[model samples]
Target chain A: MRVLALESATRTGSLALVDYVGAPLGAPLNGVRQAAPLREITLDASLQHSEKLMPALIEMLGAEFKIETIDLFAVDHGPGSFTGLRVGMALMKGFAFASRASEASGKPLIGVSSLEALAMNGSGLVVPMIDAHRGQVYTAVYEVGAALRDRRKSLWDGRPKLIEPEQAIEPEKWLKYLVEKYGSVPRLEDNQIHARNVAFLAALEFGRGAAATRPGACHRHAPTLFSMTPRYLRAGV
Target chain B: MFILGIETSCDETAAAVLTDQPLRILSNVIASQNEVHEPYGGIVPELASRRHMEKILPVIQEALDKAQIKLSDLEGIAVTVMPGLVGSLLVGLQVAKGMAATLGIPFVGVSHLEGHLQAPLLEHPEVSYPFMALLVSGGHTLLYHVKEFAKYELIGGTRDDAAGEAFDKVAKILGLGYPGGPLIDKLAHQGNPKAIKFPKGKIKDHPFDFSFSGLKTAVANYVKKIEGGITPSLLADLCASFQETVVDDLIGKTVLAAKEKGIKTIIVSGGVACNSRLRAKLPEAFFPSPLLCTDNAAMIAAVGYHSLKKGKTSPWSLNAMANQDVRFC
Candidate 1:
C-alpha cells in the first residue's frame, strides 16, 4: 500500500510518500518493519502553506506518480497553527475527493495527531511539545516501551503509550508538573515533526486495518469522504 | 465549458457548477453558518473558519451531484481567494488548488468583491459594461465604475462601518437576531419608514463616501433613551427608520456616482442587495435575484468563466488575502 502523508501543523510543513506492505485485520506485528518515504520534501517556513503546499506536492509527485496512485492519504491534524492545519487537511480532502470520484471505490484517509507525530522523535518517557503561542505550548507525555525502541533508527518502532493526555499549558507549569510526576526528566531537544514520521505512523495504523475500522478513523469500511476537523485543543474561539 | 466555483470567504460555505456558453447555473449550493453564528449575534472569525472546514467538501460535492456531472468533467475551477477572513478563505482556496492540481486543470483565484461585481452579469447578460456598481455587504460598502470584465475603478466607499454591518449592529441594539439585513427588511415593511428621523451618513469632503458608524451610534443612543424600552410596534418603526436611512444613503451615493461618471446602467449586489427597500428604491438599477445577491459560487464561477476565456489563470502559489482592492486586470 502507498501512503501520501502531509505534515502542515507547523510553519515548516513537510510531505512524504511511503510504500508499505498491507496486512489483514488484527495482524501481528512480527515482520511489519517501518519503511521510510520514497520521496520527502520540507516546505519553506517563511512562505504560507496555502502558497507552498499544493505547488510543492505537484513538483514532488511530477509525472512519475499521479495523486490517484496513492492508496491512502494521511495528514497531521493539529494542536499547531490552526490555519495551517485547515489548509493541509482541505488540500488532502480535495485530492481524496477527486481520486474517489475517478475510481470505483474511494481512497482511505487517516488523521495523525501532531503531538503524537512529534513523539516519534524520542523514546522512553517522551514529552512532545509544540509552541501554542500566547505564552503556552501544546504538549503530551508518552511512555515509550523498551521493546519498541530501535537503537539503529532515530524514530521508535511502535506507538508510544500516552501517559499524559494532550493539553495547552505554560512551559514553566508543564515542566514543573512533569518533574513532580516523573522525577528528573531527561533533557529534551526541540524537533520539527516530519511527514516521514507521520507516514510511518499512518502506515502502522493502515497495516492494522485501523483506517477501515478504528473509532476515530476518517474512513471506516466504506471509502466515502468524511469531515476530518483539526484538533485545536484550545476550546472556544 | 463546465466550471466549478468555490466560496468560503466568510461564514457561508458555497459551491456551484455552471456552463459558460449560455450562462446557465446547473447547481448552486450554499451552506449558511447563520445558526452557528446566531448565538454570537455576529460572525466570529474562528467559528466561521471551523464551520467552513466541515462543510466545504460536502457543499462542493452536492453542487457537482446536483449538476449531474463528474468532477473529472470540470474544465476549470474558480475560487474566492481575497477580501475575507484569512482562515475561512484558505479552506476554499486550498481545496480548489488541490482539486485543480489533481485534475490537472487550470483555476483562478477571484476576489470576493469582483465576484459580487460579476453577479449581475449572470442574471442580465445584456447589461452592458461601463456601469456603476454598488456593492453593499457586511464586509464592504463601495461604489465602483466597472469599465469592462476584470476592470473596476473605485469611486466611493465607507469611512467606517459597512452598510450591512450597520444593520447588524443596529439589530443587535434593537434585540433583533443575527444577519440583520433580512430581518430588518421583513419588519420594515409593516412600519412607517418616516416614523423616526435617522440622519443619513455623509462624509464632508468625499460626497460619495459614507460613514455609518455615526448612524449605528445614533440608533443605539435612541434605543437607550427610550423610557419603556421598545415595543414590537416601536421596534418595527426603528427597523423601518434604520433601513430607510441605509437604503437612502446607498441609493443616493450610487445615483450621484452614476450621474457624475455619465454611466446610466447600475448594478447592485452583495449581501445587502437583498434588502427589499434598497431593491424597491433602485427600480431602474439591475439587481440579481435574492440568491445571487448574497455570497454564492455562481457569481464566482461566472467571473471565472470570463477570466478563463481571456486566458487568465492563477498560479499554484495563489494565496488567500484578507484584504485586497478589486483587481482591474
Candidate 2:
C-alpha cells in the first residue's frame, strides 16, 4: 500500500510519500507492528505552500511513485497559518476528489493534527507550540503512552492521547495554565509538523481501520466535510 | 478551443465554459451567497469563504454539464486568482490548478478587475479596442483607458467608498436591506430625481476622480433632519435623488475620460452596470447583460481566451493577491 501525506499547518510545509508492505489480513503483525514505509520523501516548503506544494508532489509522483498506486492521502489540518491551512486543504481535497475513481479505498483523505504530529517526536508530556503571533500561541498537550509490544495495544486506543484541547492563548498565560494544572510546565518544542510523523500516524490509523469510516476534516475524530476548514481558532472579521 | 473559467473572488462561486473561435459563452453558472450575507447587511469574509468551499465543485460541474462538454474536452482552464478575499480566492485557484494538472491542459490566472473590464467583449463582439471602460462594483470604481487586450491604463478612481458601496450604505441607512443597487434603482423610478438636491461629490483637482462618502453622509443627515422619519414618499425621493447623483457622476466622469482620451466607445461593467438607472441614462455605451454585469466566470473566461491567444500562461506557483493594481496583464 502507498500513502501520501502533506503537512502545511505551519510556516514550513512538507509532503511525504510512503510505500507500505502489508502483512496477511488476519496476521498478528497487522495489529500494531505493521510494516514500515519502504520509501519516505519530505521537502521543506516554508511559507510557500501554494507555490511549492503541487509542483513538488508532481515531481515526487513522476520520479518516485505512480499516482494510481497511492491508496490514501493525508494533510496536517492546521491550527497554524491560516493561508497555509487553506492551501493544504484545497490541494488535498482536490487530489482526493480527483482520484476518487482510479484509487478507490472509499475515503482516501485523512487530516492529521499538526500538534499531534509534532507530539509524535517527544516521549514525555509533549506540548507543541505553533506561533500564532500577536504574543499568542496555538498550543496543545499530549501524554505519550508506552511503546506497543503486542497485538493488545494500539496507538490511539492505548497510546498517545490529547491531554488538553488545542487553543489560541497568550504564551505566558498558556505556560502559567499548564504549570497550575500539571504542577510544572512541560517542555515546549517547535517541531513544525514533520511529514514523516504525519505519515506514520496516518498509516497506523489506516491499519486500525479508521479509513473504513468517512474521512475526517483536518482532525482525527470528526468525519464530516465541514471539519476540513482551517482551525484558525479566531474567525475572520 | 474550449476554456473553462472559475471565479470565487468574493460571495459568488461562478464557472463558465466558452469556445475560442467565435468567443461564445456556452455555459455561465454562478451560485450567489446573497441570501447568506443578507442577515449580516454586508458580506462576512469567513462565511463567504466557507460557502465557496461547498459550492465550487458542484458549480464547476454544472457549468461543464450545461456546456455539453466533458472535463477531457477542455483545452485550458482559467480562473480569477487575485484582488479578492484571500480565503475565497484560494478555493478557485487550487481547484483550477488541480484541474489543469489532471486534464493536462494549460492554466492561466486572470485578474478579477480584468475580468470585469473584458465582460462586454463576450456579449458584444463588435466593441473593439481603444475604448474607455467604466468599471463599478461594490468593491471598486475606476475609469480605465484600454489601448488593447493586456494593455490597460487607469485614468481615474474612487477617492473614498466605491459607487456600488455608496448605494449599499445609502440602502442600509434607509433600511432597504442588503444588495441595495437593484432595489434602490426600482424605487428611484417611482420618485422624482429633482425632489432632493444631493451633492455629486466629484473630486476638485483630479478631473475624473470620485468621492461618494461625503454624498452618502449628506443622505444620512438629510434622513435625520426629516420631520416624519422617512415616509414612503421621502424614501422614494431619497432613492431617486441618490441614484440620480451616482448615475450622473459615473456618466460625467466616464464621458470626460473618453473625451480626454479622444475615444468614442465606452464599455460599462461590474455589478453596478446592472443598475437600470445607469443603463437607461447611458444608452450609448456598451453593456453586458444583467448576468454578466455581476461577478461571473464568463468574463474571466473572456480574459482567459485573450490571454491564451497572446501566449500568456501562469506557472503552477501562481499565488492569490488581495489587491492587484488595475493595469494591463
Candidate 3:
C-alpha cells in the first residue's frame, strides 16, 4: 500500500510518500513493514504552509506519481496551530475526495493525532509538547514500552500507552506536576513533527484493519474524506 | 466553461458553480455561521475559522451536486483569498488548490472586494464598464471606479468602521440581534425616519471618505440616556434613524463619485445592500438579489469566468492575504 502523509500542524511542514506492505488480517501486531518514503520534502519555515504546500506537492508528484496512484492519505490533525491544521486537513480532504471520485470507491483517510505522532520521536515515558502559544502548550504523556522500541525497525510498532490525556495547559504548571510525580522528568525536545512518522503510524493503523474494506463503509472510528476534522484541543474564542 | 467558486472569507461558508457563454448560475450554496457567532454579538475569528473547516467540503459537494455536475466537469476554480480572517481564508484556499491540483485545472485567487464588485454582472449583464460601485459590508465600505473587468480604481472608503459594521455595532447597542443590517432595516419600517435627526458622518476635506464610529457612539449615548424608559416604539425609531444616516452617508459618497467620474451606471453590492431603506432610496442604481448581495460564491465564479478567459491563473504558491488591496491585473 502507498501512503501520502502531510504534517503541517507547526511552522515546519513536511510531506512524505511511503510504500508499505500490510500484514495479513489477524497477523502479529508488529508484522507490517514500511520502507522510507520514495519521496520526502520538508518545507522551509520562511513561508506559511498555505504558500509552500501545493508547490512542494506539485514538484514531488511531477511526472513520477499521480495523486490517484497513492493508496491512502494521512495527515497530522491538530493540537498545534489551528490554521496550520486546517490547511493540512483541507488539502488532504481535497486530495482524498478527488481520489474517491476518480476510483468510485472509498479512499481511506487516516488522521493521526499531532501530539501522538510527536510522541513517536522519543521512547519510554514520552511527553510531547507543542507550543500552543498564549503561554500554554498542547501536551500529553505516553509510556513507550521496550517491546515497541525493539520493533521500531519495522512500522511504528505499538501505540504508546497514555499516561496523561492530551490537554492545553501552562508549561510551568505541567512541568512542576511532572517533577513531583516522576522525580526526574524525561528530556524535553523541540517540536520536530515529521510527515514520515505520520505515514508510518497510519500504515500501522491500516495494517491493524482500522480502515474500511468496502465503499461507503466508513464508521465513527474510521475517518473518511468527509469525516476528518482537526483535533483542536483548545476551544475557539 | 464551468467554474467552481469557493468563499470562506468570513462567517459564510459558500460555494457555487457558474458557466459562461450567456452567463448563468447553476448553483450557489452558502452555509452561514450566524448561529455559531450569534452569542458573541460579533464574529470571533477562531470560531469562524473552526466552523468553516467543518462545513467547507459539504458545502462544495452540495454546490456541485445542485448543479448536477461532477468535479471533473469543472474547467477552473476560484476562491476568495484576501481581506479576510487568515484562518478562514486558508480553509477555502487549501481546498480549492487541492481540488485544482488533483483535477489538473487552473485556479485563481480572488479578492473578496472584487467578488462583490462582479456580483452585479451575474444578474444585470447590461450594466457596462466604467460604472461606479459602492461596496458596503461588515468588513469594508469602499467606492470604486471599475473601468472594466479586473480594472478598478479605489475612490473612497471608510476611515473608521465599515457601514455594515456600524450597523452591527449600533444594533448591539440597541439590544437588537446580531447582523444589525437586516434587523434594523425590518424595524425601521414600523417607525418614522424623521423621528430622530441623527448626525450624518462627514470627513474634513475628504468629502467621499466615511467615519461611522461617531454615529455608532452617538446612538450608544442616546440609548444609554433612555436606558430605563425603553420601549418597542422608541427602539424602532432609533433603528430607523440610524439606518437613514447610514443610507444617506453611502448614497452621498456614491453619488459624488458617480457625478465626478461622469459615470451614470451605479452598482450597489455587499451585505448592507440588503437594507430595505438603501434599496428603496437607490431605485435607479443596479442591485443584485439579496442572495447575491451578501458574500456568495457565484460572484467569485463570475469573476473567475472572466479571469480564466483572459488566461489569468494563479500559481500554486499563492497564499491567503489577511489584508490585501484589490488587484487590477
For residues A1-237, what per-residue lDDT tens digits would candidate 1 score against the true structure? 778899998879899987776643234333556676788999875538888887788788886667777777888888898888999999988887777567744566677789988887776788988889999999998766575555425454477778899999999998999899889666457577889778767666655555346533442432335477888998646
* lDDT by residue (tens digit), candidate 3, A18-105: 8765543223336454467888898875438898998898887775557777777889987898888999999888787766567776
**Candidate 3, residue B174: how far the Cα is off, in Å:** 1.6
Minimum summed lDDT over a 10-residue window in model 1 chain A is located at: A215-224
Residue lDDT tens for model 3, B94-165: 998888877878999988889899998899989999899999898889999999987899888988999999
Interface RMSD for each of the candidates = 1.2, 2.8, 1.1
The better candidate by TM-score, 1 or 2, is 1
CA lDDT, every prediction? 0.85, 0.80, 0.85
Stronger candidate by DockQ (1 vs 2)? 1
* Per-residue lDDT of candidate 2, residues B19-70 (tens digit): 9678999999999998888877788988888778778777887898899987
Question: Model 1 — interface RMS deviation?
Answer: 1.2
Runs in model 2 deviating more than 4 A are A23-46, A55-69, A100-107, A133-136, A148-151, A154-159, A169-190, A206-227, A232-237, B204-206, B259-262
| lDDT comparing candidate 1 with the true structure | 0.85
List residue ranges in candidate 1 displaced over 4 A: A21-30, A149-157, A188-190, A210-224, B326-329
Kindly give the stretch of ten consecutive residues in candidate 3 chain A with the minimal lDDT sum: A210-219
For model 3, the superposed segments whose C-alpha errors exceed 4 Å read: A21-30, A149-158, A179-183, A188-191, A210-220, B224-228, B326-329
What are the per-model DockQ values? 0.69, 0.35, 0.69
By TM-score, the candidates rank as: 3, 1, 2
Give the count of colliding residue pairs in each prediction: 0, 0, 0
